[model samples]
Structures are given as C-alpha cells and as structure tokens.
Target: MKKPFNSKLFFFILATLFGVILSLPTFLQTQGPKIILGLDLQGGLNLLLGVKSEEAIKVRYATLASALNHYSIEEQILLDKLVVGEDNLSFELLDSNEKSKIDKYLSQQEGLEIVEKDLQYTLALSANEKINLENFAIEQAIGNIRNRLDQFGLSEPSVIKQGSDTILVQLPGIKTQEEEQRALDLISKGGHLQMMAVDEARNARVATMSEREAQSYGDVILPFINNPQQTILLKAIPILDGSMLTDARAAYDNNGQPIINFTLNSQGGKIFADFSGKNVGNRMAVVLDGKVYSAPVIRERIGGGSGQISGGFSVSEASDIAIALRSGALPAPIFLLEKRSVGPSLGADSIRASLIALISGAVLVILFMVFYYGIAGVIANLAMVVNILLVVAVMALFGATLTLPGMAGIILTVGMAVDANVIINERIREGFRAGENFIKSMENGYMNASRAIFDSNLTSLIAAVLLYVFGTGAIKGFAITMSIGIIASVITAIVGTHGIFRFLQNSIMKSGNYALWFGYKQQVYKRKL
Candidate 1:
C-alpha cells in the first residue's frame, strides 16, 4: 500500500538531497560555493605588533605645524622662526599687527592650548586630548591594516586587537618567502606622505651639510628613494600632506615604468593649485616617510587635486604602495614583536590527524549502534550520515573558514548527533518491555526523546553563540561549526528518524518481529496496564 503523503518524510528527503548537491563543491572541488581552510589548516604568516601611540601624537603635532605654516603663508603672516617642539610648538611672529588673525585661527581649532608672550606664541595639545588621540591612533591603525590586507585579495585574513596596544594578524595562503616578505612590507609600511618645497637657496649644500646644520637653516635633509646616496634639502613645513588625499592607484608612466597616481580632496587641491601657481620655476619634493620619491619643477599652475609618485618602482611595489595610500596612512608606527610561519606540511599533518580521529570515532559509533539496537540502529545511522553532510553543506554554502578547532567541533557533533538517536532507541525498547504494540511503542519513543534532545541542543547553541561573540579567530571558527552542527542534528535526528519510523510503520507491524527490529523480547515480558 502506498504510504499517505507525509510532510516530515518529504522534508527529510528534500533536505538530504539538497545537502548532497550544495556540498558537492567542498567534497569534489566543483564550481560552486565552498568552505575555505584557515591559517592553521593552510600555511600562512602570523604577526604580533605593538603600536607606538606616542609617535602617533608626534605625527599629529607635525601635521598641525604644517597646517599652521600653511596658514601663515595664506594670511601673509611673517614668522622669524616656526619650530615643532617635542610636546608643543613655539613660533615668533614678525608682525604683531597680524597676531589677531592668528589668534582667531587658533581659537577655531579644538583640543589645543595656546599662549602668547610678546612676539612668541606657544601651542600644545591638552592632556585629555593627548590620551584620546593615542587611543584613536591605535583604532585607526587596525582599520588601515585590515583594509590593506583585504585589497591584496587574500582569503580570510584575520586582524584583531590582542591587548591595550598590540595587534594580531594572520594571513591564510602565504606559501613562499617572497609572498611572506611582500605581506610584511605592506603591513609595516608607514605610508606617511608629504609635499614639501625644495629649499632652493640652500639645497646646493645638501650633499655637504650635516643634518644638524641643515635644520639650523630651517631646512631638513632627505635622501631620494630611488637613489639614497643622493641627498636633498627640503623646507621643514609641507605644502600639503596625505590627510587631504582621497585616492591613489598603481599605474604606468609614459616609459611603462610603474607609478602611483593619486587624487586629493578639495582642500588639498586648492593648496596644490595655490602653491604651484605661486611657485612656478621652483621644485617641490614628493616625500613619503621622510624619503623624497620625486622632485619636479613646477611648470605651471597644477589643478584638479591630482598628482603622481615616480620612484622607479616595480609593479608589485607600486601596487602595494598604492594600496597603502588608498587605505589612508597608519596613524602610528607598528613594531613587529613576533613573527611565525606555518608550513604546508604542518597543515597537511593536522588535516590527516583530525580526519583519522573523526573517522575512527564515527566508525566505532556506527558499529556500536548496529550491534546494540539491530535494524532500528540502521535507521539512526542514515540520519547520522545526513546530519554530518548537512553540517558541511551549510558551512560550504556560507563560505565559512574551517580551522583545526572547527574540525574538532565537527567530530564532537558526530557523537552528539548519534546520542539523540540512542535515546529514542532506548525509549522504544522500554516501551516494548512494558507490553506496548509496535506502532504505539514507536510513538512513545519519539515523544519521550524529543524533549530531552531539544533542551540539550538549545543549551549548546546558546554556548556556541557566546563563544562566537567573545572569542577571536580559531575560537570563533569552532563556535560557528558547532552551532551549525547543533541545528543540523536537530533536523536529521528528531525529525528525519521519526519520519522513517512512520513510513515503515506498516511493514514492521505485519511482520510482528519486534525482537529483530528493536533487540527486545516481547514474548518474555508479561502484559501490564
């Protein structure tokens, strides 16, 4: 007789069929959504870095000095000297008449302390503002590092804070030394950009003058990036800096040499236009991290806030620098505290060991279930198999990363999935011992088992969610797989196995073979109320 249309059975078959199809990419390397192996499962680079928040404050001070210098030039304020002190700035105003103009500008700025004594003005960052800036720098650095790694097309890169001032980074598929070095360079690149005018009058003495002597003349000495042996002198104050930069990308120059094309925001554009328009026939140095990359003479007024950096770069170098610039400069320098690399062989061994443990446990569970419960155990084995498949299928569909800890979660899931079936089987055997018929015994078995299964699964899912929220990297991976497994087990164990019992209810009843199906001897038990 045809079994009446059963929704539970239909859903079981539908879910099983979909799991197989959706998991094909992960199982067979087909063209579809697939799970990605993380750092522990695939070779990669790991780094621990400490952010120098103090240096960030210094960078902030230098930027402020540049702004003040630009303000002086814009307002035609003469200054005998403008110096950026370690924690404060001191400048001597040549004209006391324009002091009111400078005072108005300072008043408009926030988080600053200013004082005036005769022709001298002092400016410093407030104590509370200093702490805030330091904290902001660390947070900003983390964001910039993550952004740069994402642009590299890496799969599942991990970037997170470890402590108050430290960052942890993991990259999944860096196999060769070259790839590792490239990533390290990109991560550690300061990316500080500045546009300073060449000190034309004193630049001729750059090759002969000491840094101290150069600074005394209100000039700074820097080496060309393409030729470090060739030193140049530049004005201490910048015409503009990267704070106004909006976009940068790797491109080729006329000679097909690699270069980085950059675009600036409106403020920077006007500054570039104003500086170039007024300083025609003079040279401006394009400096990055205090090293001059290029010094080009201003031919005419350059507009549109666009410029390019040419340093005789290779394609990869240019691309990396472009990514750094595009992501915005790191607020502070990060020092590498530790470096470690995991090899492919180690990853392979981990995979092999995890598989061995998983297969061994599953096989033992299958054997025990079949031996103890006979045919009823076979029904559970079917649900158990589908449960495992569904777990992998869901993870593949979501493109989740699988780490070693995640493999352990799956192994634990195998045991948990079978535990539910075991409860149902034991409940049915108890029903038989109590003199119940086949159909009624099966109904009582599921009814008793479902509550216990639901409660356990719900508690486990809650724990998994908490782990995901508070844990980082590998812990999160484990929680993710464990959570998916819990949901899959509920569907295949309680719902799927119950559907199977309903579908075969008639066949077993006609045979009257309780002993063979359930490992129980009803003939030995007395009928009771």
Candidate 2:
C-alpha cells in the first residue's frame, strides 16, 4: 500500500501553509504585504507631459554663451558681436588671423559644432548632441518629478517615459480636487531658482525708462510675488542657481512664519561665501521661476553653505518650495498635454462589478464541476479553492498590483484549474472501463494525464511571460496574475488532488468500493487477437 504521507502530499501541505502565511497580512490588515492598487482601481491623477526639447536646446546655448563670456574676460580674448540667438551662438573674431586660436579654444568644448562664415563663427549643438540633450532632459524631468512626488507623500506613483519627448505620470489614490491641483502645480512648476545681485540703479531707471532700456544696461527685471507692481532689476549674471542646492526643508521663522531653509554644495558654498563677503550690505534677489521671492541684503559673510528664503507663505507653500528646491530643477519646462482625474466612487463601482463577475464565474464553474464528476468533482473543487488562495498569496508576496483585468484572469484560472482535474478523472474512468484495479487506474490516470496538462500549461505560461514583457500597465497586471494562477493551478490540480486521492485510497477507501467513489462502473473488455 502507498504511504499516506508521501512526498507529493508533504509538498502540497507545505506550500499551502506557506501561501496561507504569506496571505495572512492582506487579510489581517497588517503591514506585511506592500501590494499597491493600480490607478484604475484606486482612483488617482494621470498626467501626460510633453517636454519642450527646443527650449532645452536654447537653454544649452544660453549656458554655453555664459561660459564663453566668462572665458573671454578671464583669458583676455576679445570676442566681439557676441550674440546669444534663439538656436545658436554667433560671435566675431577679434582678428581674422586668430581663427586657429579660437578653433583651438572651441575644440575643447564638447557637444558643439562650430562653423566659420566670413570671419563670423556660429556655434550650435551637433545632431547627436541635440538628441542626447533631449533624452537627458526627459530623463531628468522624470527623476525630478519622482523626487517631488516622493516628498509630497504620494505612494506607488508611476512615472515613466511614454515616448521620445513625453512622460506619463500616474498618482494612485489621490481623490480630492485640491490634492489633484496641488500635485499638478507642484509637478508643472519649473522651479528654476537663481540668486542675482539687485541692480538698484537699473531698477530706478527701469521705473522711469522702458523695459528694453533696462536690458540695454545688462539687467533683467523680475516682479515681486507679494507686490507685482514692485519690480527688481537683477544683474544678468547669477551668483548661484538651484542646481547648487544640496538640501532644503520647511521651517518656522522667529515670528512663526513658514520659510524654506536650504544648503548648497561645496562648490556653491565657496562661490556664495566669496560673493557675500565682498558684497556685504548689498541686496541679492532670490528669483524662482522668473519671479522674485525675496530680496535680502547680506549682513555678514554667509558661510556653511546655508541660507533661508522667508516670504509670506503658508505652511503648505513652504513645503512645496522645499520639495522643489531639494529635488532640483527640471531641465526644461513641461507642457500638460493631457490631464485626467479618476474619482473614488468610480473605482468603487469598478471594484464591485469586478468582484461580482469573479464570484459569479467561480460559483458557476464550481457547480458545473460538482454536477459532472461527483466525488472526484468535489476533490477538484477543493483543489480549485487552494489554487485561488495560492494565486492571491503569490500576488501579495510579490507586491503586484491588482487590476480589473487581473480579476478576469483569476476567473479564467478557475476554469483552467478544473480542466486539469477533468482530464485526470476521464483518464481514470477509461482505466476503470478497461478492468484495471483502483490503485493502478488512479496512478495511470495521473501519470498519463500529466503530459497533456504540463504541455498546455507550459504554453500558457510562455504567453503570459511574453505579454508581461511587451504589454502596458493593465495588460502587464493581467499577465502577472495569469502567470501566478497558472503555476498555482498546476500544483493544486496535479499534486493537491492526487495527494487527496492517495490519502483516501490508503486510509479510508476499500479496494472494492473504488468504483462507487470514483463514480464509474468496472467493465471487462475483450480484446481480439
């Protein structure tokens, strides 16, 4: 007689225990499994952003112009007619014979193509360099948005590159309109911060003169946030920008007003310390997104790479500023191509409908199985229950998101799980009709049916893998649940049901009663030789 406690039974019991333990956290509402619901299931914000690649190119050119301006002054190179155009930089050489000298200087600069025409040189980014810059901008934008979202406390956000110059952002579980707006504003804001010395003389002149007149004097006018009528003219050169910031946090000032305190990196610290030490008592404009937040005069040489931006801001505003500052600036501005908000009520309806469909399908499958195979059917039903449990447990264990399609996959699995049992039962019935003993017929049923079951399930598993690799969000969810279900079905339908049959045969069922339990009649067949 076969032992009641065989290796297959032992494995089935061990797997069931492990799966139950893994699934316990989900049932008990504890902090074990970190499974997150998808955006469709939880209701959240979805934003599609288009990166302004052209603007990125322009910004790169402007930065290069700044570098050239600095080099010209430091190296005593007379670069005349320096024009920072929209798409390229153009400059005239001081001497036509000095073309070789300028070429040597420019050869050291990377990502640039220099062209000479009639003693005038134009510099633009190479084609490959432009593509690389655009790609980098998109990548950096994703990273910046992710950092901001992390600080904003939204969990399990999906921020990925959708296309060449577009990004897809999904913030799960955000239901409120205020929250939606806040998240959108937080992400869309460019957050370009710069510290430039306030040009008081130019400011006074700009008040009396035209806007173009101030530009002629190498000044840029930015309006104050608190008082838009009041504007400050800042030097064209900035002392430091947000890229130098290492950390930022929200804090309360002496008067209990919210403020953002920031720390700069080592290089920024040295530059800021030097600039502040030499320009004590001079006002410096704190500009963010082209708007002046504050203009404070330096009281002393501010060292330690630390400073504060204090304005009449609310606590939430201060927090937003801190998050933006800490996350650094986006490489270029983003345009909101599409915006969508999913309400919790809609998600709730989806969940209810999905649950109904799943339960209805499972119940129907269970009833059909019980009606067709009788005692064997009951055993299959038990295995099906275990199969579902193992599927959920695996999903929870892997922290995979559950979606509406995933529910459909589970429903489909119920039918597939029963199919394996049906194959085995039919094979066993065939063996019985051929006048085989109960033990020999049952063993033959499992062994003969195993090949077909393995082949079918193996093909399904391969399809699931391919779907997961190439499919999008919801499709990937379906593939994941389907893969887990297929694996669980194989274990339950074969090992789980076979172990139960072994136990029944070894411990409960008598050899003579096998035909009655198996729901088949033993028939002697004559073979013609």
Candidate 3:
C-alpha cells in the first residue's frame, strides 16, 4: 500500500522550487544579463527643462529685426509689445519714421503679413504658420535632447516632451551618471572649432617657436559663444554630422594607447573623404558643442572614410569620450538641479519591511486556513508555495523589471493565489459533510470550483491588461506583475493543487489513510439562528 503524502514534505519541495526560481534574477544579473535598472535602484541625475516660448518668439522677432535692417530701413524700430494670443503672435511695431517702407518690406514676407495703419503696424503670423513654428521648435528641442543623450552613451534613455515645452528624461541605467547632466550642458553650449594661420618657420625654426606660435600653429580653435572671437575652418562641412554616425567604439592605437574609432554612413564617408583629400597639409579641428576637442594636422587624404581620434587618454576616459562624441550634441544647455541616490540603507529597510509584511500576512493566512479546515488548509498552503515558485519562474522567463510596487504585487498575489485553493478545499469539505467518499468529494470540489476560479482570475486578468495598456512606467510594471501572478495562480490552483490532492487521495486509498488525506478530524461549525 502507498503511504499518504505528508503536507510538510510537500511544502519543503515547493519551497525549494521557489528558492531556485527567485534566485534566477540574481544569477543572471551577476552574469551581466543587461537587465534594465530603474532610476531608484541605480543612481542617476534628473533634469527638468522648461521650454522658453517667449525666447523662441524673441528669436523669431529677431529675424524680423534683421530683415528690417537688411532692407536699409532702420528707424529705431521698437517692438512696443508682443501680445501672444491663443492662436498666433501679434507684435506691435512702433516707429514714427520709415514705418511705411518697413511695413511694406515685412508684409512682402509670405507668412509675416503686416497691417500698417498710422504709426503702429501690427505684425502677426497666420494660424498655420504659428502651429508650424511651434512644432518645428519642439521637434528641434526633442532631437537635440536625443542627440545629447546619445552622446552621453545612455542606452535607451527615455526623452518625452510632456506638454508644449517640458521634456521628461528617464535614463534607467547609465554609468558615470554625472556624465549624463554634463553632456547635456556641453551640448547646449553650441561650441565650435576654427582654423588660423600658424606663425612658424620650417623644421629649422621649430625649437625657437613661442607658446603663442605653437598654439596658433596647431589651430586657433575656440568655444562657440554668442559673440565669438574667431571661426576655425572645419575639416568637413558636416555634410551629415552626428545624424549619420552609425556606431562608435574605443580601441587602442598601434602604440597601445587609447583611441576612438568611428564609422560614418555611405554619404558621410564620401563627404569626409572629399574634404580630407582637399585639405591635406592643413590643420582641421574636431569641434563639439563649439569647443575644439582635437586638432590633427592632415598628412594624407582619408577617403574610405573610417578614422580614429587618438588623444592621451586612459582606457575608461577614452571609452567615455567616444560614447559622448558618437551621440549628437544637445540643442540647449541642461543643468542638473536635483539628484537623489538610493543608498544601501534604504534598500535594507525596504527588504526588512517586505519580510515583515510577508511573514505577518502569511501567518494570518495559514492560521485562517488551519482553523477553517484543519489538514486541508495545510495542503492548500503547500500549494501556495508552488504558486509563488511558478510566478518567479515566469518572472525569470520574461525578465520583467521588478520595482517595489511589483514586489508588493507579488506579496499580495500570494494571498490571492491561495484563496483559489482555499475555495476548492472548502467545497471539498462541504462535499465530505454531505456524505461523499474522499475521492468523490475531492473530484466534486475541483469540478465545482473550476468555474469560479477561472471567472474570478479572468476578470482580474482583464483589469490588469487594461492597466498595462494605459498606465505609465511604474504602474505598468505593477500591472504586468500582477497579471502574471494571476495567470500563475489559476494554473497552480487548478492543476497543482488538484494534482497534489489526487496524489494524496490515491495513496490514502491504497494505504487506508483516508483520514490523513481528507482532514476528517475537522468539524464544520453551523450558524446559530
């Protein structure tokens, strides 16, 4: 005769499975699985950008100012006021003299039609023009941020413009996190490089060259400022600049020193080759954000078009520089105003809190189960452990990022998953009270509970799906995890619990241990009317 299955023994095996599956993330993460880290888990910078609509309007008005100057009709024109209506920008230009000619010239510009009456000429944009301008500025801003983040070597950073002007950047995992903000600042600077004549004789006079001579001999490159002193000659006119670079990596030079290797696209290659060939023996500067990073004297033409920039750099620094250069520069400067790092102390607190919550909740559930149905509750609790194991295995399989909210979802799911088994077990207890045999009652309980279990979990699964569809990062994470748990609960409750129960039933029948399988020692409490 087969011996009845021990509930304690079942729980031990289930626990082992749970432990193995839960450990998968740690093992995979240790092996560098490239899992996405949240901002809280990995320290990084957060930048809040406020788009200057007035500033954009000022630039547009400045263009008008320039156009007025170009036409040689300058009468100390003052943009008396810029009234920003809901649809367009209305500028009140007040200039007593040359007002008629200036108004005529401005009206000639297609989108910038003007209304000239007396001394005040109201210059306003059409509805479509205003919308187009706003869209173009926003697109430019977004592209700039994208380029900056790319240069900073942030992998898959999130850059979304919230309203008309606010940009939300969420970079989950970034090395040297400070570099993120620094790169943003540099890109915004809009620096450039320039070429200048070198005051030096041939090789014979090299030893006598002054500091100023050496600096000029290389290239008089300077940062691009609102008012710059000089303009350096570009090696290439950037036929296709940062937009064309497919990939960039850092490697060692022949001397085993750090260098950045970059590859340009087909069009970029041709432009680079043509420029390099034409500019042999001339010095060209590699400018980024208006600053000259390196100025190499061209010896020969490079046409096949892949090149390396070798500066005296450490390995880590070389890699970082290469990453930043490859990613396009930012359009506007961004400052890191706020930073908060997640310390190990906070992580420890979270872990302890989670443990306490899990233990307390599990104890309550176990007590409720035991008091309600005695031995049957113990079996269901054993199944709950397996449910958790299945959830973890699924998590490992999908590789979902787990947040604190997701952990809460997991803990909450533990109780909910067991509720399914509890319902089925209680139904079996009722069948036993109705004078059915152990095996018959078990089958009846499962069959009756199957519909309720499926319907209940299915409804929750739908809600989870909807939440995932509409929710943002963290909430979506919670919904996804809860959904997985619900699905796992259904399978473990219906299949796992039934399988264990059936296995125990068969053993009890063979070994004459019916009381052990059915919890016949427990009595049902009747309600007093």
lDDT of each: 0.89, 0.82, 0.59
Stretches off by above 4 angstroms in model 1 are 1-3, 71-80, 93-104, 428-448, 520-529
Question: For model 1, how does the per-residue alpha-carbon lDDT over 1-529 read when each residue is reduced to its tens digit?
Answer: 4464477888999989978988888989889988889999888998999999998878878888899888888889998778776798878999889988989998987899998899798999999989999999889999999999999888889999998989999999999999999999999998889999999998887889997887777788999987889999998878899989999999999999999999999999999999999999999999998799999999999999999999989999999999999888999989999999999888999999999999999999888888877788888888888988898999988888899999999999989888999999889878878888767787898999899989999999999999999999899999998999899999998889888888887877777776677663334433232
Q: Model 2 residue 250 lDDT?
A: 94
User: Can you give the lDDT of residue 263 in candidate 1?
Assistant: 97
TM-score to true structure, per model? 0.90, 0.84, 0.65
Per-residue lDDT over 44-124 for candidate 2, one digit per residue giving the tens place of the 0 to 100 score: 988999988667787677567655765665466787767666677888878766677678878998988889887789998
Stretches of candidate 2 off by over 4 Å are 21-35, 65-83, 90-105, 115-122, 160-166, 427-448, 508-512, 515-529
For candidate 3, write residues 311-376 as lDDT tens digits: 576786666556555554333334443344345455456656876887788788888776665566
Off by over 4 Å in 3: 1-164, 167-221, 224-239, 281-283, 310-314, 325-337, 397-399, 509-521, 524-529
Better of 2 and 3 by TM-score: 2
Candidate 3 lowest-lDDT run of ten: 191-200
| Model 1 error, position 79 (Å) | 5.4
